[model samples]
Target chain A: MTTAIARTIDAIWKMEAARIIGGLARRVRDVGLAEDLAQDALIAALEQWPAKGIPPNPGAWLAMTARNKAIDRLRRDANLRRKLDELGHELEDSAMPAEIAEGIQDDVLRLIFTACHPLLPHEAQIALTLRIVCGLTTEEIARAQLVPEPTVQQRIVRAKKKLADAGIGFNDIAPEDFDARLGAVLQVIYLIYNEGYSASSGSSYLRLSLCEEALRLARMLVHMAKEEAEIHALLALMELQSSRARARTDATGTPIPLPEQNRNHWDRLQIARGLKSLETSRNLGGPPGVYYLQAAIAACHARAVTPDATDWPQISALYSLLFELTQSPVVRLNHAVAVGMAYGPSSGLQLLAPLQTEAALRDYHPLWAARGELLYRAERHAEARAAFETAAGMTRNAPEKTALLARAAACGQ
Target chain B: MKVIVFVKATADSEAAVPPTAELLTAMGNYNEELVKAGIMLGGEGLKPSSFAKRVHFDGPNRTVIDGPFTETKELVAGFWIWEVRNMEEAVEWVKRCPNPMFTASDIDIRPMYGMEDYKEWDKEGGWLEQEVKLREQIEAKNA
Candidate 1:
């Protein structure tokens, strides 16, 4: 029973910690102090809840507890007495104020933007966002990204200290910079999702929690910035890609190539959600951004009930638009694949040939894999076998390596 | 909102032994109740920490440490992600779970943040239209 209660408290803390801290940060105007007060509330819950039974509204309970702690702390500080007087009435009230409750989402959004501040390094932004916004422990963040816990700890600590030293307020993002800041925020979220979707170097192909976290954040962003077509596009792209997660790997966790995957395993709900978001982006009525174009390409595949039914021409067209928008060699490589599907192996090969020496694709595994597939389709078995072997050697993911090696063997046969 | 209920690892779980059939049946029945109530989103058991590894990072340096490192109390054995109205509803469901261990065990519940929480941020006023439509599509697809 003691263990049960302890676990319950632990769980509650993980869920409410961010919100509690975010709320207090708004009230206190100090992230570090807000976090400290929230931690105090957690400790209090740990000490009191097991004996008292869990509170009725655990989140509100924690927030109220933290608010009281903040009030007490402020009362002692001569400099903060005026602030304390301002907050005292609300803190003393048992019921949380409606405005405070309504502002929780804003607080979280502010917290994420602050964590991903442009002044901070990319790694620090990621570490800080995972810790503060996602409520992941240092150890869990380390494990998720395959970094050392202390390294993650250092990044988080340094990030916090940097923000404090820079005198960056939680609401520092100016209105004019909202679009640029939103771009940074979207980039960080997409990076996390991509890492989860295709781990840079891991045995597993998917990390559901990271993907879910990214999706959750994207959903939140869309809600926050309703008219932002790019946000909707990004969300649509993630949803479409994530819909294929269940079919991306075999029963034994080995990756199955897209063509061989059982479409029945595709998450129809996610696909529906993706398509809906895509429609919203279209309805918003602007030229398609990179994400929107990619989402359109993904939609082409998702709309197909079978691999053969896929609209390769539409996908190829979307890729061309994506290439024009981003000028990314990776996009071009993907476009090559679509071209191959729509046109012929030789046409795909012609597109792939330019990218082979494009510097970026030289050591990229997918580039080699695509080349191998195109070559195999052209009946250039020996060259395809060699390309498959090179692709197999370049990849670090275990499942991807296994699939590549299997493809290489098929080429030999 | 969704909540993830974590089942804490016990000494037996740390030892990597499977649960007894009776205990499994009990847990299954509990899961069935959750599903029947339309609360369960997903659930799964985890392998022992023996298969886990921790990477310690020091700036640019990294060192790996093997798991099964004598911290049974801190490890997770399994978890169930449930969609519930609030933390209170989740707690009520958790209170009915059978003991998940041969010995003493504990379950913890944490709520998942949702897009609805930020609905007020729609300054231009149509921000949540897409999200609402998408959610309905998801519900219909699931149904």
Candidate 2:
């Protein structure tokens, strides 16, 4: 019964942690201290709830308990008397659901911006976001990230310290800073997702869970900022991408590539969700950002009943817009492939010409791979073979190298 | 991992009466929570056992057993398939779910098997390969 109660509290915490911490942070003006207070309240619940049974309004109880702890901490540390008085007047009934709590979403959003602050290391950002936002324990973070527990613990500790030392307050994001801050938040989520998506070495379940966690966080972000097109777009991109995850690779861990992947294995549910989110993004009506463009591209693939049904012209158009916005060599490479499919190999080769000298692409294996594909299509078999050999030499992954070499041999044939 | 959380039937659910508005709202909120947390994959409220049938197979002999079956609690009133981090997480998520039926009820969390669970038997990766192919075929007819 006690274990069961603890798990119940855990589930409630998962539902209410962000709001609780966000509310406390508003009072204490210290995100880290607010979290500490919230955690203390959680500990108190674990000690009491198992015996007392869960309170009728558990989220309220947690918030009230944490607030009292914050007040006590402030009272003990006499230097912060002014803040204590500010908090003193705030005591009241806390039985309401978290969403109905006034300005709670804004508070949570502020907390997210601080937790995913750009100054923190990428791993630290991930740790803090999972802990404070996702309500995950350090052990859970370590497990999901495939790192040692101590490492995750230290990342959380140091990340909070960095926020404190940098004097990052719990203040709402200013209008000017919103875009950059939102970008950081979105990037951290997408990074976590990519980490999960690319991780082929760990327990498959954990890796997939990481992707789900990212999706969860992204969904929360969309809730918090209902007006942001990119947020919905990011969710769409992830949903669309995750839908095909089951068929993206073969038994040997060799990538199936987009066209060759079994369209049937693509998750229709997630595709529907992606398309819905994409529609939402369009309704929000902003200049299509990187995520929006990519999601649009993914949507094209999803709408295709078969590989041949894919509207490469539309995809190439989306990539062109994407390349114009980001000017990323990777996007250019993708655009080349789309152009090749929609137009011809010669058109793709023309787009690749500038990327040939791109300093960033000189060592990039995919550039060579794309070149090899285009050249093979253009009937320059010898050139395609050399390009494939170069790609094969550059790749560090064994399966990828083998695949590239096989392609090279295919060109010879 | 994923789990199928079944809301076991109580006498109240077996009656096939619609839930009270309060219960419906509570469940709606609970479902929204599940979706917001990104754990709810899919779920449905099942019709009572009076409308269900069980096919029993004994040594290639097939028999259809009609409902309503006598085992009241054994029948499922509803179920949810959730993608969760672990059995613990699944249990925790289910713990907060609102009462699925009037009166006392139980929600059983059964962790589904994944490819990794059968890795020991997949000496040559055949199981994993076949699982992917099987998923592909299932989608072929539906997706």
Candidate 3:
């Protein structure tokens, strides 16, 4: 009714909707149905809440409302008989055990798995995740992924139908299947966070919302599978990076280098949360997953009081572990930058020498960006300027281009 | 007031229609806000004009316009329906809503007529009642 009321309701919904829908999907075993029921509940709220006043526990209220709507739909739909037979007679939402919340998380995780399912193209998986699980509309998903909106819509529709047709149960898969699904989940989360950290396109460099969603999803995974050290590590890594969000950009949305950023603006709470999660990974006591290693590296950054105080050696060591685990050219490129800081630019440049020929990374803007940094550090200003120029040319984001161009100018100066 | 918010999509404004991971994240947050507010009533973006076409008729003639239309600004994107108290309320909400693009964008809102607007039509009803009933049935099926 009023601006304040609308804003308050909006804030609560953003925080709670994912978990509520996740929980509902687990019960219904149908992503589309779960979303529909959730929306129905939202509609009921829109009609009722302004007059009744906000509920004391809005999340529980929404969940309860969604459950009721699901039951009502089950009763009223023409296919009720067959649907009940398939879902079992005890499919009422209110009767759902507390364990179903856990089930919902599993569904959310399963939805992630489905979106990231290897059967579909990478673009399709991304588009589907943003659409189904993230509750983003198809157009928004398309805009985020930089594909045409129809392309995104088709991918999502196909993704959902594929999941339904494949008879992919929302609950447990085989160990191998679980691993495959988890890999997809990790990739989707990483993609979302990476996009937020440094936008692939657009005028602004940082997108706090996408980063926050990814971080939240990652954390949900951690809670869903606590013993998985890699999950904890990934969560920690995301949290640590997110801690730097406020310091990532200037007032005009230009990229701000870590060293130049006002560290005070970094979220101390997020840094603390990240470190705690990292501790959880360490306590699990196995070789860290790729995400864990990266989190460890981020933790080093978080712990540092100043740029000079950063633990380059430790970060370099973590990157070494990550390189061994993932073998991604991008990982190696990052390791090279860390090595430049840990030892000397010569060693880093030597490592980069071989990578320059790596086909996978030939067009990667960050590879050239790292090379430029190494050369600049080595005082090969002219070569560094060329590298930065190349990086600036390759990048699509305005802020990243600005950063690279500024670096290139400094190289000649 | 039952307002039909028309969401028109166009790809002509930019060379690339694909959103970066970062922009998706921001847009995701914005959508979450909309959904939470209870203003969102069925919204989605369509594919580019390349996969789309329009059919029209003049007297008994038929015409088709393939997508990638020269005038994208005039194109109709996807839209949402909001049941607010009045048009002024809808305008206030739209004014505060985030611009979907970093460049610039606009949304068009049109009010939908309900049963109350049908008094004169009802008085002259012949096949209109049957048409209205059929429409209701279709809406129920879709819902």
User: Residue A70 error for model 1, in Å?
Assistant: 2.0
Docking quality category of candidate 1 according to DockQ thresholds = incorrect
TM-score of chain B of each: 0.77, 0.82, 0.69
lDDT (10s digit) by residue, model 3, range A1-413: 57766655655554455667768777767766776788787777777788898786777888899999888887788674475367554344324345543533455566666567766666667766766556665665555555688887787777777766765545534454555667777887888878766762223222434665576567556656767777778878888987886566543445677877767768786798799989999999986777888889889989998899999989888888888988888888888888988899999999888998999987788889889988988889999999999999998978789889998999876
User: How well is each residue in B11-129 modelled by candidate 2, as lDDT tens digits?
Assistant: 87888978999989999998987776667778998998999999999998999999999899888898998877667678667767777776888889998875457554675667787
Q: List A-chain TM-scores for all predictions.
A: 0.86, 0.90, 0.78
lDDT per residue for candidate 2 within A247-270, as digits (tens), equals: 787875667888898776788988
- Model 1 RMSD vs true structure: 17.1
Point out where model 2 deviates above 4 Å: A1-16, A42-65, A82-106, A119-121, A146-151, A201-205, B9-15, B46-75, B115-126, B129-143
Give the Cα lDDT of each candidate: 0.78, 0.84, 0.70
lDDT of 1 by residue, B24-137 (tens): 899889886565343465689998899899899999999999987687888899999875545755876787788888898888887765433433365333544465456658
lDDT of 3 by residue, B8-123 (tens): 55553333467668867876776665544434434666566666788888999999987666666676655666644346556655655556555567788898763323423554
Superposed on all Cα atoms, the candidates' RMSDs to the truth, in angstroms, are 17.1, 4.9, 21.8
- What is the Cα root-mean-square deviation between model 3 and the actual structure? 21.8
Estimate TM-scores for all models: 0.69, 0.84, 0.61
The docking quality of candidate 3, as DockQ, is: 0.01
Q: How large is the i-RMS for each model, in angstroms?
A: 17.1, 3.5, 19.9
TM-score leaderboard ranking = 2, 1, 3
Q: Could you tell me which 10 consecutive residues in candidate 3 chain A have the lowest summed lDDT?
A: A200-209
